[model samples]
Structure formats: structure tokens, C-alpha cells
Target: MNKQHGSHEDKAERYELKQTLSTLQLWGIAVGLVISGEYFGWSYGWAAAGTLGFVITSLFVAAMYTTFIFSFTELTTSIPHAGGPFAYARRAFGPTGGYIAGAATLVEFVFAPPAIALAIGAYLNVQFPSLDPKHAALGAYLLFMGLNIIGVAIAATFELVVTVIAIFELMVFMGVVAPGFSIANFTKGGWSGQDVFSLGAIPGIFAAIPFAIWFFLAIEGVAMAAEEAKDPKRSIPIAYVTGILTLLVLAIGVMVFAGGSGDWTTLANINDPLPKAMKFIVGDNSGWLHMLVWLGLFGLIASFHGIILGYSRQIFALARSGYLPHYFAKVHPRFKTPHRAILAGGVIGIAAIFSDEMIKIGGQTLTANIVTMAVFGAILMYIVSMLALFKLRRAEPGMERSFQAPFYPYFPAFALFGALVCMGTMIYFNPLIAAIFAGVLMLGYVYFRLTRSQRETPPQNEVFEPSEELA
Candidate 1:
């Protein structure tokens, strides 16, 4: 009897994640998961809609993310599950909704890192012209996956350090370029490359939605780490509220500074825009330009490393819930990290990095298409999450909520509306990627439906039960 009981305890331990993240660490994960947007990907918006037009798209996106974060915090605190949106949707709408949410979140987290990793390689290439960007990107995946597997606390600490440095670097970038910034330069040909806005620019603005969303795309991934937070209910709200505000300021500051520094056209399609923008201001040989090249890497690293952490948790949670193969659910015995999940995500990201040269769609680079696909996943998850929030409010009225979304129905309603608009525009502009995204989700659903009987219930300790009020 004693030996049987010990085996059962060991089985339960295999699925548990350690709780060690504090408020500051949680804030770091929130910002770190997205800081790379200010560095590279958002510049593509300039190519799609020009400066002023993209700005309009950005503001709309910022509004959606702000409202979404405010509303999302309530669910994070109430459920506090590693599955994040998946857990909430499962409780509110059952297995199908949970599968959709989990699959979408997985796509968002998994696809995001490769884009950031490529940007990291681009930054390194600026310094070492002989090195292949793809090789550097692959190396990054290996390095960070090791760090994450070592332990969550160690990973979170590293994320916090890099995130702070990245933020400071952006402030430095704005200050260095301030003297060269010109409002006339920024607004020149600011509407779909035309000098003035016209009815024609409407399509460009809509097309810019994905790049605009890139500016704040993965900020919501913080919810994945809620299960590992030391004080999730109180700490998550503070971290999320403050983190969104921080990214908003950084995104705008970085964009304005880069656009106004030189010919905005030159920065539009490149992965190393900040360094190139700095070159225009300081000249290529200046130490300041060199410094930007080296330090700009941290912004990309912060996001790449942070998103790897996010994707692994999502995979682990899905596996734990039997939505994915149980092979991925095992936590490392000593480190208590999801080793298989981290390695699994890294393999996917590395494959993407390798395929960069072989793939191009709609004349956009692999990085751009990857960014758009990630946004598709993110927007879909956002729409489903908001719907779950509404359903849960009615279905479990007395469910304990340490933090309530301010303005309730209005805030979430607007978030839902904005997400739907973004989704519609993205599909209109990027039909091929949209189709691919849909296909991935459908395949996942089929697997989920066929395997319903084989699904394993998580251990009792891993399950989240509502308070007595829910009874």
C-alpha cells in the first residue's frame, strides 16, 4: 500500500509547475513578451500604410489592446490557470471552446518567437556581416530553450533584467534621435506613400492592422504565467495594468523617433530599422550607431526569450488537460519546468527560421507572414476570450473574482468589437495566411474531437475549483 501511494504521488508531481514569480517578474514577462515590436516588426506598417496612416491604425489597435487587457485581468485573477484563456473557455463553454482557445493561443505563442528570432539574427548580421542570420536565429532558439528548462524562476529573472535594459535602450534611442526628428519628414508622403490622405488610403489603413497589432501583440501572454505567480490575484492586475501603459508609451516613442529621423521609406521593410534609423542620424561609422546595433539585440532577445516561455506553458497546459499528447505534459523532476514543452516549441521555431529563405507569400518576407499569422491567432483568441468572459459572468455569477473589470460590459464589448474589426481586415488583406491559420485550427479541432475518450483528467491538485459561492 505504501509503495502504491508513493507512485501515485510521483505521478501527480510530474504535472506541477512551481510558483515563484513576483509582481515585478510578472510585469517583466508582460513587457518582455512584446518589446521586440518596438524594434522591428511594426516598421512594416509604414510600407503598408505610410506613417500617418499607420499611426491611425496603431491608435485603434492600442485601444483594443488596452480594453482587452483591462477585461482579461478579471479572468486571469479568477481562474489563475496555466492554460489561461483555454481554462476560462473550458469552464464557460466546454471542450470545443476550450480547444479553439488553446489552439489559437498556441499558434499565437509558437509563431511569434520565430519572427523575433529572425530579427535577432538581423541585428547580429549588422555587426558580423559574414554570419548567416538563420544560423544565429537557430542558435538563439537553442540557448533560450535551455534557459527556460533550467527553471521558471531563473527564466523570469532573466526576462526581468533584459526587459528593463530594453526599455532603457528605447528611451535612449528616442533621446539620441530627438535632435534629428522632424515632423515634416514624418508626415511627408504619410498616406499610402502619397503626400496627403485620400479615400484610397482607407484600404492601406486597414491593411496595416496586422503590423499595428504587432506593436502590442503578445502582452496578453502574461496570463500563461499566472499559474506560476507567487500572488496571482493581486500581482497580475498591477503587472498587467502597468505593463500595457508602459508598452503604449514605448511603442509610440520608438515609432515617432524612427520615422521622423530620416526618410521613413528607408526604414519601412527592413528587420533592423532601429539600427538603420540610428545610422541616418549618427552616420554608419559613429560609435552611437554601433551601440544601437549591439543593444537593440536585447529588445529582440527579451521578446524571443519571453515568448518561448509563454508557448511552452500553453503547450504544457494543453497536454495536462489532454488536449495534446501526454508526452509534452511532463515537468522536469528537479527543475520543475516543462522541459518537453520548451524543447518542442524550440524545434518548431528553429524549423521556421530554417525555412525563411524558402518561403514567401504575397511578396512579403517570411518574417512578415509569420507576424501576420501570429496576429491572426491573437485576434481570434481575443475574440473568444471576451466571449468567454461574457458567458462566465452569466454562468457563474458568484464565482470569486479578486479583481473585477472596470466598466464591465462596455469595456469588453468595445474590445470584442475592435478585435472583430481587426480580424475582418486581416482576412481581407492576407487571405492566404488567413486560410492557413483556419486550416491549422480545423486540424486541431478534428484531433480534439476524435480523441475525446482518451483525454486524461489532470491531478486533483492541478485542477482549479470555484469557491463555495459557485455552489
Candidate 2:
């Protein structure tokens, strides 16, 4: 009887992830993984759809993300798996759906880090004239990946500390830039060569959608740390809610301050938007400018390190569940970390950073294009995960749940509707890249179908129950 009731403990032990993360640490992971976006990537939206247009696009993305995060909290708390969206979709839709969710997650988590790594490189180059951006990026990948492989506790602690500093630096940045923030500067290019209601403006906002989404992109990655969290049922919800709120405020403040400090056009596509904006406000060689450039690296490093942690756990979960080769799932005996997964993700990210530099489409650099591709992956997972949530409500009505998504069908429906609009807009503006993303998903599905023999069949009726856990 006691063993039956202690299944949670058994599951925890067997899952292989060390549970050392508190709500604060989880919040750190959540915020740190996404802080870099407020520092960069998002400004590219201005290039696509001027200042006001991008701001409008961001409003839509913000709504989608807010609703999505709330609904997603239910899944994270109820399921509590490192696989995150993959685990939820797997339980709701079985192995095939699981693979699709996992693939989307893999794409989102894997591709995001390289984009941040590139930004890290850009920030370093601003501070160190001798450093090449690519070399700086490669060096960042090497250092952070090693740190992640060493241990999760140390990694999470580092994430918390850096995230706090990054948050503070952003506050300081806003204070310094506030005096230069003219409404005239912010509205200078509100529509960028197209009338507000023109068909051309439609595609402009569509093109800006990815960058808008960048503001809060990987905050959902908090759920990926669920398995490593202490008291996940309680901690996940707190972290998710707090993380989204933090990102929301930071996103609005950063965008408004940066755009108002200078011509939005000039700052639009740069990887170091904050430093550039600071230079506009405080002169090119001012101490404030230099300070921001250095502190800005912490924002990049926070996301770089946090996302590396997310992708490794994602890879580990997929491999352990037989979705990939078993070798990648092996946790380090001493550190209890997913060393193989971390290194594998690092190798892939480094290659992506190099490859993206060589590829360009319609005048957009590899970084911009890859950012779109990653958002495509995230939107796909969002759509699927929302559907999974609805399905599980019906399929597993009797299942225990620590958190239930408020506004139920309405909240999720709104999120789904927003995601679909975003996806359609993405496909409209970048059909070829969208097609390629679809092709990748199709290939993933086919591969999983053919390799069904390799995957171990999980228990039939208890798919949502954490296997090998205490009751």
C-alpha cells in the first residue's frame, strides 16, 4: 500500500533528472532563457514593419503568448515532464503525435540558441574590436555548453544570478534612455513605405510577426525543466506566471525605449540594439554606452545558457523515451547531467551559426531567416499542444490535475485562433521557408512511422501517468 502511494518517488528516481530546482530557480531558467530577446531580435520587426506597425504586430503576438502560457501551465503542472510539449502531446495523441511535438520543440529549442549565440558574438565585437563575431559566438557556445554539461544545480544558480543582473541592467537602460525618448522618434516610420490599410502593409506586419514573437519566444521553455524541478506541480505554475509577466513588461519597455531613442530604421536589424540605442542617447563613447555593451552580454549569456539547458533536457527526454538513439540519453554519473545531449546540441548550434552566415533570402540574412524558421517550429508546437490540452480534457477526465487552465475552452481557443493567424501570416509572407518547415515535419512523421518498431510501447491506459512513479 505504501509502495503504491510512493509511485511519485519511484518515477522521480527513474526519470534520471536531478530535482534541485525551486520556484525561484525555475523562474530564473524561464526568464533567463528569454531575456536575450528583449535585447535583440525583436528590433528587427521595425525593419519589417516600421515602429508602430511592429508594435501592433507585437500586441497580437503578446495576446497569443499570454493566453498560451496560462493554458500551458495546466499541462506543465499536470504532466510535469522534461519533454514539455512533447510529453503532453505524446500522452494526448500517442507516439506519432509525440514525435511531431518533439520535433517542433527540438527545432525551437535548438535553433533559438544559435540566434542568441550570434547576438552574443555581436555584443562582444562591440566591446572588443579584435574579436570577430563568428569567433566570439563559437567561443560562447563552447564555454556555456561545457558549463551546462558540468551540472544542473550550478547551471540554474548561474542562470538566476545573471538573470537578476540582466533585469537590473534593463531597468538602468530604460532610465538613461527615457530622457531621449521622443514620441516623434518612435513614430517616424510608423508604416514603412506602405499605407496603413494597403495590401503591402499586410505582408509587412506578417514579416514582422517572427520578430514580434521573439519578445517572449522561449519563455515556454520553463516547462522543459519540469522534471528537474522540486515540487513541480506547485513550482511550475508560479514560475510560468511570473516569467510571462516579467517578459511582457520588459518587452514593452525595451521596444519603446530603444525605438524612441533613435530612428527605428537604424536600430532595426542590429544584434546589439540596446548598446546602439544607448549610444544614440549618451554619445558614441560615453561610459553609459560602454557599460550597457558589457552588461548586455549578460542578457545574451543568460538566454544562451538557459536555452542550452532546455534543449539538452529536451534531447534527453526524447532519447530516453526511445524517440532517438539510446546513447544520447545517458546521464553523467558524477554530474548527473545530460552531457551527450548537451554536446550534441552544441555541435548542431555551432554548425547552424556558421551555416546561417552563408545563407540569405530576399535580402534577409541567415540570422533573420533562421529566426523565422524557429518561430515556425514554435507555432507548430503551440498549435499541437493546445489541441492536445483539449483532447486530454476529454480523454483523461478522471486524471488528477494540480492546475486547471482558467477560462478553459475560451482561453485555449483564443490562443489557437491567434496562433493560426500568425502561422497563416508567416506562410503568406515567406512561403518558401514555410514550405521547407512543412517538409521537415513531414519527413519527421515518416521517419517515426517507419521506425515504430524501435520505440518501446508505453502502457496503454496510463499514458498520462508518469511511468515508474509512486502513486
Give residue 321's lDDT in candidate 1 (0 to 100): 76
Could you give the C-alpha RMSD of every candidate to the true structure, in order shown? 2.4, 3.7
Query: What residue runs in model 1 are displaced by over 4 Å at the alpha carbon?
Result: 1-4, 195-197, 456-461, 464-471
Q: Which pairs of residues collide in model 2?
A: 6-470, 7-469, 7-470, 7-471, 8-469, 8-470, 11-469
Q: Which ten residues in a row have the lowest lDDT in candidate 2?
A: 457-466
Q: Candidate 2, which segments miss by more than 4 Å at Cα?
A: 1-15, 197-200, 457-471
- Candidate-wise lDDT, in order: 0.90, 0.87
What lDDT, from 0 to 1, does candidate 1 have? 0.90
Question: Candidate 1's residue-wise lDDT over 1-471, tens digit each?
Answer: 999999988887899888999999999999999999999999999998999999999999999999999999999999998889988888887778888899999999999999999999999999999999989998999899999999999999999999999998898899999999999989998896564434778888899999999999989899999989999999999999999999999999999999999999999999999988888788989988888888888889999999998999999998887788888999998999999999999888888878856768899999999999899999999999999999999988999999998999999999999999999999999999999999999998889877765464443225544331111
Candidate whose lDDT is highest? 1
What is the per-residue lDDT of model 2 for residues 143-226, given as tens digits with 9 covering 90 to 100?
Answer: 999999889999999999999999999999999999989999988768876788666666678789999998988888998888
